[model samples]
Target: MCFDAIDMRVFDELRKLEMFFKEETRRGCSIIDLYELVQHAGNILPRLYLLCTVGSVYIKSKEAPAKDVLKDLVEMCRGIQHPVRGLFLRSYLSQVSRDKLPDIGSEYEGDADTVMDAVEFVLQNFTEMNKLWVRMQHQGPAREKEKREKGRSELRDLVGKNLHVLSQIEGVDLDMYKDTVLPRVLEQVVNCKDELAQFYLMDCIIQVFPDEYHLQTLEVLLGACPQLQPSVDIKTVLSRLMERLSNYAASSAEVLPEFLQVEAFSKLNNVIGKVIEAQVDMPIFGAVTLYSSLLTFTLHVHPDRLDYADQVLGACVKKLSSKGKLEDSRATKQIVALLSAPLEKYNDVVTALKLSNYHHVMEYLDNETNKIMATVIIQSIMKNNTRISTADKVEALFELITGLIKDLDGNHEEVDEDDFKEEQNSVARLIQMLHNDDPVEMYKIICTVRRQFMTGGPKRLPFTIPPLVFSSLKLVRRLQGQDEGQDENPFGDESLTTPKKIFQLLNQTIEVLSTVPAPELALQLYLQCAEAANDSDLEPVAYEFFTQAYILYEEEVSDSKAQVTALHLIIGTLRRMHVFGVENRDTLTHKATGYSAKLLKKPDQCRAVYSCAHLFWVDDQDNMKDGERVLICLKRALRIANAAQQMSNATRGILFLREGEPQVTAAAIQSLIELINTEMQSDSSTPDPAADAFFASTLRYIQFQKQKGGAIGERVYVLMFLGKRNVENLSAYWFTTKSFTTNLMV
Candidate 1:
């Protein structure tokens, strides 16, 4: 058993003896005999202990003054001088005489026996107990110091209980706690010159007292923090005190005025500053933890004072500035938490961004930790759905998260591909959330985002740029809508405010992204911008967008399949565009057809050329319908298909064309039927059960016409018969001759 447990058992027996004496007194027996036992006791320890027990009952009997009895008992018990025994003996006296202390309105209260006597009793016992506790450390041999310290730690609560008793006294109001209670406690705690005692007792003082008492005497309590042994964790001690007061201030709104009245925050801030300054060897983790606690307190007590929060962050930054980059994990983790506190408090990253030193603090984190913090910041912005409404704010927000946006200096580690992508994706999502109601200002925001994302290098461009592109397009539409009926342009600068200018900016951004060689995404964004331009009736701008897309296709899109996809997208975009004049339209269409015919594979060329046939035949718009040109394009597609079949026969040794051959053949047949109906105006087209049968009969008709030679028949014969050897299975094709003939004739 520990010494305290054994002492408790001994005290239990002493308790029985006192109860026996009380019963005798009730029966009118002479309790005076207890004093005789005190004098005649074999050991001074027991003698003084017996005197204290009997003195308690004597005071209750009112035979002598309570103050006199308590004073004599406390004075007489000092004779033992053995640290452990004396501490427990005093502990026994305090425990037994707790209720009988002559305090206000107590049963033992009278003229000399007042609350002062009670306060004196507890404070004196506390002072003596702390003395004995500190003395325990020096009594043992030097080598056994750790063992003695362990024993002392077990008995610490005995000394701390005295403070607890002082707190429990009803008469110890704020004035008493301030003037007498706290000062006396702090005096002993500082004078102990022992690290363990100073740490434990300081924490005891903060915890055992009410927060209001601490606040009222903030200076005195914080004044003693730096006077302790340098090894003490003053940060943890101060943190606890601040946490208590913060909670106290948060308990109700009515208490906040009192907090401000006493300048609690300033006092605490000053003291923490002094403590950090005094403890020159304090670890960065300890320093940051201290600031984090202060920040939490500031957020609670002074929720509206953003300057206070910023001051705390700025202080943290100053502390970290001299330490270089924080390489220690524990310190970095603490810094991350410190930086995140305001983000969580305001629940808006923009509010955190308002603090000038927020990003300054983040600069101390290593690369990986920096990215994690950046991710957290982004998640907060997204979670709150806060719209970054100004270009400056957007710029600041991106600057704060620059770690996630780009590679930091000296970061040589190979980034995990998936993790990097996810972080960039989060930044991308954040981009979508940035908006401004003013179109001009919104344009500035896009420009700001573009400038920021441009530094992310090629890898991040694919993820970060598209959102800005889309956002720019959205702003374009808004500006176009606002420009409808106003005499003056709703947008400000002619260079920047017009929808065309925004498209111009988008084109430039996509051009940068194209250098990343992300042709597919670049192409798609270009097309979208083009379509938006078309909608705005900005014909020149729309044509420029298409021209950029085609340029990217020819230069950047190299793989055969990608070329096929790019060419088709171009054709689709061009087919829908009505803004292009005849010259521009023909130029772009010719480029599309030229690139299609130059594909790496003949089959790709064949499909691309046939798809391009739609560009020349815009049925919906009356401006660009050249049926003869359409016939020439289909005839070119058939020729490409025929060449592809011949190549396949020579190289792969296959009988029929590849996957695209059937579509080519079907397109040619439909175009031929259209041409015949347009000239001859015949309605003999009917659905046939077999496509091969209809195809053979058409060839026979063309062949018979070839013998009797007409210009139309010659053209149709050449278009149909060019790829005749490539048709292995007409039934296998997705399109059938019957459906094509029937639909075309109608």
Candidate 2:
């Protein structure tokens, strides 16, 4: 290590030197006066230190002798033979001269020879520093290896400063970098044969040079990989270089064609190829790691180039398969992850790559062990294909899906369903984008997906078919307005230019999925399709699907709970039907209400019938000012409620009476009180004949309820208690009106 634990006495001396120079420079001492002070200082090390300090003052003053002062200081630095002291003295020299050193092409600074001398000066200091750094490791006790390494880490930047200064040179073009700079730097890296030095120096080289210079001299840079110490990680160096090149591709994408050119990947491949072959006994994992990093870079730079990625991955798959190096599970896992990296990073480009090279790579990875990688590849491919929204791409998507499922053990049957759910979603997204404004194209893509499902066999269809159907239905609703009862014309409207074709595709999906084993799935999909059809105003199609659901419920569906749900779905669909004329809607409403009445459980029948009763009476829309049918529905609902109540099923009966009982009893008493009060208060000299008759009818009903004397009697008494004062006046008025009518009749 260049740095050591400084004795207190030595620290005090260095501190005094630092302070004296600081004070002297602040006092505006002439550079000549400072320079002569170095000459007069007796000892060699102190003289060199004072010379370097005064040299900085000279350079800052812009004096002519600053160069002379720097040159003389470098010459005098050789006097310190002790490694630790010499390294620190050189570090001090590099720091002081860093800014003042002549940069290339600077008219005020020195010429090329003078600049080279400065670089050489820093390089010579670095070489000696490294030698000293390595020699310090053995000087201490063998047990001190841990402690020695700690000290060496602190002082590593001292040696690295030379490389930093070299990179900082201005106007050093490709020729200079390739001819003069690189050879000299590589000489040091090669001669050291030390892992730490080689790794650190190589990393500095990768970072400090311009990417174009690396591009021009990629061979030289990569050629040094094989010469590195065995412990050196060549991947780090290669990875940094590749990153620089990829950024070059990004920043220069508009102007330069070099990075995007096909030959770029080949060049990268060549460099990595040499790196692998150079080391005869390189661990297969190590070689795989390099190629993996290179593949990622290839994708990043040429993301639009399918062939380049294919070529790179083809080599990787070949190497892994031919060598049989994927022995352990961990290594195989790593390789799988590495090969999957390009898909994760460049998802948008995967579809194009799939069109060209994905299948070739899949052919090699076509086994059960590589199922995860295959899945990852297919998922990325499908995602991009969907985003592009071209119908022609649908066939390729299914092909990839088929391949992925085939790779799964027993065609994905043995795998957990969760694993295939994401792929299914991707297919759904494809269906979503598959529809553009063209309905015929939409039909073609949907039919293609349906056929693929049929070809894939029936076992997985129930799980996978719903998304396709759902996506199709969603496509329809989005094209047309989602509301079912709207008056907007969907057939010729520009918003949904082809509503008929969307309807046809939906029907086609339903017809295809009807034969699957999962009847519950069929029921759910049919219900969805019917509602979507209603929303689009395809009422006849909606009725057709509704009928299909009823058939499923009656025949295939055995679960009582499922049957209840299906019945509710039928009623709900029927209720949304406003486009059908009065006669048609009334007929459908009657059918739904009848189905609700026929439910097995008495409570379900009560609830379903009561809910269906609302469909017969639409407020303000029914022109016939008659409550005859409403009364009929009320009577049937009352009967069902009575049946449920007689069964002594507390939970079941409460479901009906939650609203029905209070409404029925409240209406009977409230109507009588309201009619009697209104007819008596009007002193119109002539009584309305209709009000007379209505008053008679309500009084008769309440009188009947009062006579029954049970729960009904209690409700009637409660109603009468609230209107008792009004009831007395109403009874007197009713008797008088009745007597007056009788006299008139006589």
Candidate 3:
């Protein structure tokens, strides 16, 4: 009959059988009555199910013959010839007899035939189920192949259940399990030669059996791997087995040591080694994936077994080496993924692996492969262990690091530009892991890392080296005992415990960064060190680092915006140097004006020189004592300001005027007037020729703009303040620019 019609009739008969069993049990019927009723059934399906139900009842009786009943049940299940019907019938028999079967323990002194018959019965049922499952694939029409495959997939559990029963059977010792049971079960798996059957049944065996049994017969199970169908994913199978073994070691760690003393791990390694060598047709990715699984298992079982990890890595290396010129295929990616897995506590695993392979594994792969492996190695070091205290561990770790950054080979003529970015990122992560309590040791490690970046590649150094320097500076600051919660004193504490060493490292780091071409970064690093030094009362060191910043600004950098930024930075840095005595103060102030006069833009020069004029005089402390020096700076600023205004007028007559040039010129004029007003507010008593001449040049410039019909209202106020301070000295200038005063009052 077709399966659809049989399914309906079977369920109807099943419902009727369920009702009949309940009635008969309520009437206290004997086991013999049910058995006789089962024997008299008319069809094949109902008869098998009824026989199983009766056998279960008979086994429940104290005086029933379990061996004979089990024997009768197994024989009756074979009566159904329809593949689906026979498979379901065997499924019913296995399920019903699960808890009802006799316990044939080791003390079974009864007839040995009984135990053998029961074993034979289960083996017989398993064998029939396999035949039925395999045969169902061919029973349907050829066009329904997909449909047949789906149905078979759903029925796979019925085939695997017989194995679970055999495993649960009472008196099956290691010898019987190895000699009789395993061989018979594997015969069905191998003899079927179906991919789905092989994969599913192998998985079931790995999961259903005890770890001790698998350990005892590890060789046989792994040897059976070769007999699997060619299309099956043997990697997945081996991975599952390895996972089971690992979990066994984890849970039963205390007592299972005896079984796994030295024998289990060696056997496992040997088995995987043979598998890797024997699977000549296996893809490199599959073999590497299996090795990765084994690596995890080895670490779990015996983490101290470093040699086994090497052996596994060696197998991967050999496989990767055999493949010629790996493309960017899935196989290559899988190999990289396997290499990236954390076999030990983070970077230590990577460090050990790299050390073991020396340069062979790293150089054997493509650039992308090496890049990925290097990234994962550095990341693992960052994430795994933070207890990097000793010199040996740090040395080994940084040796691997140096190789990752630069090449072991001295050839970089045709380097891949893409990998350098990933390497740069890896360097960032490497630095993050160096926050050790021992700053001196950390400083040494950072210097090594810094030197690697310096010599790693010249092209990426500008973009990469600054972050390492900054991280080093942060380490220095931390070592010098600065706190975020406290008020920021640019002169860090003079009584710092480690000031000498801190200044030494900070100075060395900044000096090295000065050689790189990143001007803005260099400026910031030097400023940071200078501020830190000044805070610590190391005046000479502070002045030296600050001078290094000026050197970069003057000689190395050419961007006008950067130069302007540096000028402003110098002024801000010098404003805090009020603690310097007279000679040192004069030296820094002189350098400040020198940098100001060296600005490339006229507007930037005018603004910066006027800004630096404050350093020469102390208003609150000395009552405009150096006002004559301030006036001389303003005189130079006015010349630059007038020159800048003339340049703007020149652009205005041509076709070269930019969008915001006039507004910038007007703002510079306003800034110059504000500087004069500041001097008038502070030095109302100093009689200096330079101040009078500078104010008169400014008044004529405002009059020139007023003659061109431009508004000079803010500049006019500077005239009013200067006139209020010295009306007799500026009467002629006020009349020369009379319209500015008129426009201001109006």
Candidate 4:
């Protein structure tokens, strides 16, 4: 019968009997006659149980020497050879006699009794119970062996309880535990040759003892580990012990000296190695888990010793190297945890980078796992706000996370698009975190990032390269600030440290990104760099950037809307540029107007052409303005707007439509009025005939719209009214607002 199915009431009856013995003893019953019951009872199991209960009370009563009573009862209980009955009977004896042992201050400690006697009693009982428990495994038929093992496992606590009792004894100090208690218990655990018992009792030894005792007696406790049955989970046993010791070390700062005094880490390190060597059949997962636990212990106990942490990683690397790459999910998961533990502890990836074998251990993980680990490494950097400041450090960081940066070994598995993008985007964000206080060094960092991200293929270039471009531009601004009053280069490297040279580098990087066919982003970056150059008064550099943008707009920007937007940006950027001489300014402005005129949609072309009128007229600087060119741009815009209106009317087959007035017409009217105002304000006493003709044609168009007398005419009248208020010397013009209003009334 299983131990669980046995009549629990039997234990109740035993409790009743135990109470009876206690009452009888208190009432001064015959203690000698009570001891005689052992020899006279029918069943040996019942008789031994009764004798132990009575012996407990008899010892407590102080009628006889407690040592003699304990010794007689222990030897007498050995008669019942049945495993189940023997284990329960011994468990009963242990229970009833727990407080009655002849330890130091106990009632039975007088005369020849001592703590040793108590130790002897518990160890002897522990040995017998372990033997009986191990024997139960072999008693059943081979087919029922598993069943008997299960039964034996349930009964293990009954056996382990003795060690608990041993640990609870106030008299058993570190000396006694090291000398007698630990060794005797390990002897039975080893000699029993049962996997279940060895596993359980070794764990019991670790748990039941004080950490100080474990720390002091680590060698003795760890020495018995290798002697256990081969199938025993020695790794789990050792891991638990190390975990406990680590916690103990972490519990008090004062206790660490003792750990070092005992060479705790060294002893654990050696024993784990020894255990791995002895347990040759252990799986790689188990070995790695053992190293992981040891790492935790080291981090807790010897957190300052990085070499020790590295040494643990090195050991893991060696073990993994011998086993080749770990394909097992559990092993790889453990390896990731192993690598991440230090990151979490220090909350710094830079510190993790200092460990030599940190990345070496990662080499054994598969690609997907490597990506996961790489992501974790990046997260550590971001979470800790760690700055990877040097070029070499950036290079090292990229190397560590190469799996996320690019495809390795040409593995073509289809990655989820969003997931891949997110991973690469994290790499991009990490790029921004790469900073150095030195401008020259910061330049080198950007170069290093570019070199690394260039290999990320076209898919990653869009995400990764823009940060480099911006970083390079940022470096330029810094160098310019440093060069404020100095003629000589602040950095000795003139070729590399100069703002112009860095712009060249940015041009090259953005050029590469453009080849990724990401023209829009490329164009945006180019314009940004151009603006920065203009701010720095590097006119030639600014011209080159604008040139690159124009080339992209002509060659790559195919969408009509994109072209319109690009042209507006080009015109707006050129309008703000002050460093450009007339030649470069006009050359770029001509290209901008030409591109605007060539847009796919007429409305887009008309609006872009009108917007380009600003490029020809510079309000902030004098020499860059060309009134004639501005008049020409306004005329060209008016013509395009009229063409676009004609096309709209033709397409819709509607004449003089009041609703849905084209935006281009209003834009042209606005630009024309501004240009006429500017011409009137200029110091030219005699206006050019072309400007006069342009102004006359605009007035004629307004009169034609006013004749229609609808929304278009009202909008035209409003435009003329606002223009009359702003234009100076309005009497100089042939067309006046009053005359137009008079014509409207008539």
Stretches > 4 Å off in candidate 1 = 26-28, 481-493, 631-746
Better of 2 and 3 by lDDT: 3
For candidate 1, write residues 1-746 as lDDT tens digits.
Answer: 98877988998999898888888788887666665566688889888888878878888888778888888888887897999999999999999889898877798998878898999988898889899989999996899999999999999999999889889889999988888888888888888899999999999988888888888898898899889888998988998998899889889999999989988888888988998899999998899999999999999999899999999999999999978878779898888888888988889877887999888888888888888998998888888898899998988888788898888995657878898889989998998789988877988888888888888888899999888888888887776643342223222236548786687678788988888889888999999999888788777677777878888887788887887778778887888889788998899889988988888887667667766766766646777866566656766776776576456531111111111232335455555555433322324223232433444455565455446764223111222212333233322221422112221111
Model 4 lDDT per residue over 460-571, tens place: 8998888788778777888774333323332223464778668777888899989889998899999999998888877777888998998998799898777767777787
Better of 3 and 4 by TM-score: 4
Winner by lDDT between candidate 4 and candidate 2: 4
The residue pairs in collision within model 4 are none
lDDT digits (tens) for residues 216-330 of candidate 2: 7777777777788767777678877887887787686662475644356677788777767676566777776777678777777767766776777677776666665355564
Clashes of 1: 0
Query: Which tens-of-lDDT digit does each residue in 106-180 have in candidate 3?
Result: 322145335565677788888989898989888979999899998899888888888888888777778988888
| Model 3 misplaced regions, further than 4 Å | 1-12, 18-64, 76-82, 104-117, 136-148, 170-180, 255-259, 324-426, 435-447, 455-459, 470-517, 523-552, 570-591, 598-603, 614-631, 634-746
Query: Each prediction's TM-score against the native?
Result: 0.84, 0.62, 0.67, 0.86
lDDT of 4: 0.78
Please rank every candidate by TM-score, starting with the best.
Answer: 4, 1, 3, 2
- lDDT of residue 431 for candidate 3: 63
Name the lDDT of candidate 3.
0.66
